[model samples]
Target: MTDPATLSAAEAARRIRDGRLSATALTEALLDRIATREPGIRAFVHLDPALALRQAEAVDRAAKAGRVGPLAGLAFGVKDVLDTADQPSQYGSPIWAGHRPRTDAACVALARRAGAVILGKTVTTEFATRHPGPTANPHNPGHTPGGSSSGSAAGAAAGFFHAGFGTQTAGSIIRPAAYCGAVGFKPSFGTLHRAGMKVMSESLDTIGIITRSVGDAAFAMAGLTGGDYGDPEARPGRAPRLGLCWGPTAEQAAPETREAIERVAAAAARAGAEIVPIEMPEPVAAGLAAHALVMNGESADALAWELDHAPALLSPGLRERMEWGRDQPRAAKEAGRAAFATARAAVASVMADVDAILTPSAPGEAPEGLGWTGDPAFNSLWTLLHLPCVTVPVGTGARGLPLGAQIVTAFGRDGEALAWAEWVRQAAVA
Candidate 1:
């Protein structure tokens, strides 16, 4: 029998609901796994064994009473930036250290309502920006696990949780997941509630999920959508018409990464999907540039209080970013906004002919250091376009590290993105 802690959320939930497995037993297994792995991975920042046990007991009670929810008896990790009433919501900066929110974030509340236990708070980068955390990759402890959602990705990969919360202003979710060998799904902008989440860039800070498989991701997305502050975009029904995209950034991808995309696309094509070659449009190319400005300016504004009051606590990289945002010319900011609108329209025009596009999840496998998270170059454009994307692991790289390929659907077509991703994953295995 598979270890209960190692089971995917979908499988674990089923067994718990059938009374084949008790929530208490499952939770104990997961907690034990975390205890064993947390020392080296440093994936969790705040873990309350008692709180998790209590939550598990509640789920067991509900299950025995025949009142199980979709995620009953499963555990999900929360990024430190997301508020947790019982845990400190320290946004990965010394300034907010030990700060606890009076209420859970909207997403957390929904997860609890669906019967999943909030396992712990995962480590995040400083303000979910350039600053790296102490988390090490679960695959290779010497290398980085990527950021700023490093811990959530590593935690999911290490089986500390079935699925975990992540956020991507750039490649925070995908890059980390790719590096850690997990499925990372970034829903269409505003698809998940962000009310109690730490804000970086309003335009690009999308809530996301990290899971072991696309099916688990789907289960989570199904339950997380339709919250008070969520974007209830209708998912289209049909086999996806996918376009193969390439650009200047594509050239920067490691040979292994490029090969992985080609392999996955070929497999999907052989499986009856239409694959068209598409170039990065000019406006979309320009929007990628604007992404940096929008993120920098907004991050500066969002963390202005800390910049002003706690200069000593701010990281050098973050301090520089804030200062640059503070000094940006009005024209630059406006140009970024204009560029975004144009690129958004251009991408939509092209999407009319296709359900989604295939792209690289990262530059390559996780880089060989813990000092920095790998580049977000491949993920920026789609994020800027507000498209929903899912990164599925297609194969391993030269070093045995996982390589992922992205499936990106038009804005508001999250279901298409996820469905196509699951298809591609299945095809790869076949």
Candidate 2:
């Protein structure tokens, strides 16, 4: 039999349901893999092997009784920023260290009820802000795994879990998944409920999923929201009309990113996709700048208590940004919100001719150091506009690190986004 630890969530669930694999056996294989690789990866901040086994055992027993949820036998990691009753919901900060919630975050609760085993809580950046955590890229330990969804991406890539819950306030979900050579699906804003999450920027904080394959992301989303995100193997009836967009951040893209985008475009074209070279509308392009102002302003308010009472506990950089946010003129915040509103209203027309926009997922491959989490220039605009986005690893860069292509669709088109992402992935690999 294939190594159970490496199977995708969809495949694992199918195998378990088919009576070919037991949840307990799959969980044990993953635990064994983690025991050997976790020390160096540091992908998880909290892992209780016994608890994981207990969940898996219960799943196995439930299977015998013909009671199975859609996600049975699938093991997943929860980002630390999301509350988990069994594990500490430390938002990657010293101030909230060992913080536990009385109930699971909505996403976690839904996953658990759907029969997915909670493997552990993955590390997150402090307050899911600029400050990164200890997680290193699973591909190269010297490089970063990206943040603030660092551990979720690294864990999914390292086979520690089949899927992971990630949140994006900016590019947390897609950027990390790109850097770690995994698939990231940042659904339309509010597609997944955010109750019990440490939301830094309410406008931009979107819950997402990261997995080894686009199909796995679809599977996880179906279980989490009970939505028909479609099967990974199901291809669209016709080749999609994909807009090949360089976006406003094209100048900032490394050679690897540029090359990767062009390569994927060429491959997708050959596979019958209509690759249109489209320019972003002015209002939408302006949202890149607006994203920062809105994030900073909202984050300042979100962390006000922390800044007021335990200011010393906050990171120097975060404190400085929050202070700046606190002092910003009300007009500044309003202008930022206005920019987003304009962009969101204008984006529909921009996407009217294309099924989705094809862009770079990051500036380049994972950088050589873990200090910085690369740039979010390519991703922030879409996030600010409330678009659905997905990233799939296309190839490697000069540094042997992975590069990814992002597929973005209009708001409320998450299903289309996931389907198109799978198409792009197949085209790139074919």
Candidate 3:
């Protein structure tokens, strides 16, 4: 049976506005489903039935008054890595098990303003890195769900909420969405306010969202996007030229991903959009490596105290990464940042001609087994330079798993990126 909890945010809002649904009933319905699915999925680190209902009741009351706003009565599951004043947001590590904040992150605040119920904090890999969380894929329990947004993707896939929020330091958002066969969006770097999200590597971390479809993703983003949260220089504007790059990514893509792109590209061609083939500078291939250096090295600095105080609290592999982060040379960090800047300039030249670039969101379908999460090599470049990006689900892979093609516009061109992604999404649908 298709669960009411599985409906998208837009659908939920429309139902509520028409008085066909009450926010309280929707919240309870989602909680019931979460209670059933969470035992195996372990998608949430925290759940507050009372608070969720309380918020829902407020929405219901508002609707009774005919005051329903754009997102009135919607619900969302958030990654534990993002701060939430109301819940115990443990960072998937035992060290901070009872941690709670006094305020919601900027993104959370935005959602609340739009009348979204804060369902609860979802699971995240320790500090949003490679350390595995308990989250498993919703499709097959034996397969690994990707991270560090494991819980957010899992929750959305399992119908726990209309949409969910996750952070992408290193494919945390896109990889998990692909693994869960859901649509995920990582807005261009710095577009979404990160005032309350937990800090990983300041250089690469991005706040992102996961939904059932690209249209849902755009709906969720419309509320949170604009200027740099409150910064004047962070303002959004017209989208730049769109450039298309596939070969650099295609060279190493899995067979399934290649086929999905071929199918999507052909479909897009039929829709009358220019599908150009272009090569990224040789340095982009190196961007992944550089991203690793910045992520590991900077992460070492952010969690140095944790590593020193509670090494046993983290997963074994993560502990080793900390040791590695501690020992990695200073030169790697310098070189990585320098290379990132250089690559940004090189990419800018291409951006001058095109409004955006369409690339594969992941290498292929989510792999089976639960040991390790999927790869983020394909997602590293844009994350590094903080470029605004959107993932358009083009089609399914060999196993019926979802596949995505990413649309990347220049940094801060989030509005344009979303529009182009919408255009591509509708074109494919047609």
Full candidate order by TM-score, most accurate first: 2, 1, 3
TM-scores of the candidates are 0.95, 0.98, 0.89
Number of the predicted model whose lDDT against the real structure is largest = 2
Q: Looking at model 1, which ten-residue stretch has the lowest summed lDDT?
A: 227-236
lDDT (tens digit, per residue) of candidate 1 on 362-413? 9998988789998999888888888888898888899888888888888887
- Give residue 193's error in model 1 in angstroms: 1.4
RMSD of each: 3.0, 1.0, 4.3
lDDT of 3 by residue, 1-430 (tens): 4455767777778888899888998899989988888999988888889999999999999889878876777788989888888888777778988998899999988888888899988988878887777788898778777888998998888878878998998788877887787777787777677888778788888898998766567667765552322211232243233455773556778898877776666766776666777788777667656777788888888888888898888778877877887798888788988888788877777776777787788888777776678888678777876787777667777777767787777777766676677666665666
Give candidate 1's TM-score: 0.95
Question: How many angstroms is residue 155 displaced in model 2 relative to the true structure, after the best TM-score fit?
Answer: 0.5
Per-residue lDDT of 303-367 in model 2, one digit per residue for the tens? 99999999999999999999999888889998998889998888889888899999999999888
- For candidate 3, what is the lDDT? 0.78
Global lDDT scores for all candidate models: 0.86, 0.92, 0.78
